[model samples]
Target: MDLTEQPTFAFDVFSKACPSRGTLEHVTGRWGALTLGALYEGSFRFNELRRRVDGVSEKMLSQTLHALERDGLVHREAQPTNPPRVDYELTPLGREVAERLLSLIHFVQGHMDGILEARERYDTARGGR
Candidate 1:
């Protein structure tokens, strides 16, 4: 397989055709979304964030925080101490995005009952009952 021999897809990740794809990926990554949502509450230490976001491993949390920091969406501070506590919080830009994310979360929570009911109905219907 040589270069330029593969089929081309609709999206040109090389050319950066779409603006939202990268942002969407960053915001909805395995740990990115959870990180943003958690930071919405307030600044939290690494352990606190890990505990708050269930199922997230320490490495993933660290990677997510680093990515968010590089993107300027998160601020990381290290305290001067023997253990050297580290905390993360959203920047102004990050806060704006977090607000939007909160709204989306609220919308989902509000409709969860209806969604569950719909799912149950769908399952029953598909079961041929």
Candidate 2:
């Protein structure tokens, strides 16, 4: 933890002032979700992550990884080499949340057909174009 950053021992996400809201947003948002899911497979460097997550621009992926790293969900390691190398992987806390996210994704995938059919029915009834 940085000396400039204060510690929050207790937090309430329902409250607008809670820091957890920002953390939750980082973990659950589009790029965050995909990044964590990809890292769950194995460690990856910057370009590899850019490839694994389709359509995520360099800036967006970097921002997402930065947020996750700040939140203690991802570990960034810098290695000493001629050119230097950095790799990212899930911390223990990160692995816990990644597993949960993967389970939620699987659950949604299992019901996708049903969800699509329901959406079609609703659209038809509502005269959607």
Candidate 3:
């Protein structure tokens, strides 16, 4: 291989040392998932994203955005304006990921009633702990 050539890596998320694990965590984490799902709708300003994600704190949203941006799953655009507008949107990769996540989200939502019943049964069996 040429000295200037970069080595290709085959990443496996199951490996403890794999970098993909970090990206997976970022994409699947509570705030990260919520943030990505919100961005899937369309581009949103920082405050708008915060509002869309609902329960996420400003600090958490900022951190989640930073992680997603670092992972190449989100794009942050800052405009030169009086108020300094900043917008967040999903990259193509981000959109692809969001599409998959949305499928899971919909599946869980559709089965929520059954899930609740299962949970109730489990709780009752465990003495309502």
TM-score of every model? 0.78, 0.88, 0.92
Candidate 3 per-residue lDDT over residues 1-129, each given as its tens digit: 898876666886777999999999999999998889989999999999998999899999999999999999999999999989999999999999999998988999999999999999999999997
Q: Give the alpha carbon lDDT tens digit for every residue of 12-116 in model 2.
A: 787899999999999999999989999999999999999999999999999999999999999999899869899999999999999999999889999999999
Ten residues in a row with the worst lDDT in model 1? Answer: 11-20
The alpha-carbon deviation from the true structure for residue 93 of candidate 3, after best TM-score superposition, in angstroms, is 0.5
Question: What does the lDDT read for residue 22 in candidate 3?
Answer: 96
Q: Which predicted model would earn the best TM-score?
A: 3
The regions of model 3 sitting more than 4 angstroms off are: 1-9
Residue 28 lDDT in model 1?
74
TM-score-sorted candidate list, best first: 3, 2, 1
* Residue 110, candidate 3: alpha-carbon lDDT: 100
Question: Relative to the true structure, how large is the alpha-carbon lDDT of every model?
Answer: 0.87, 0.94, 0.94
For model 1, name the residue pairs that clash.
Answer: none
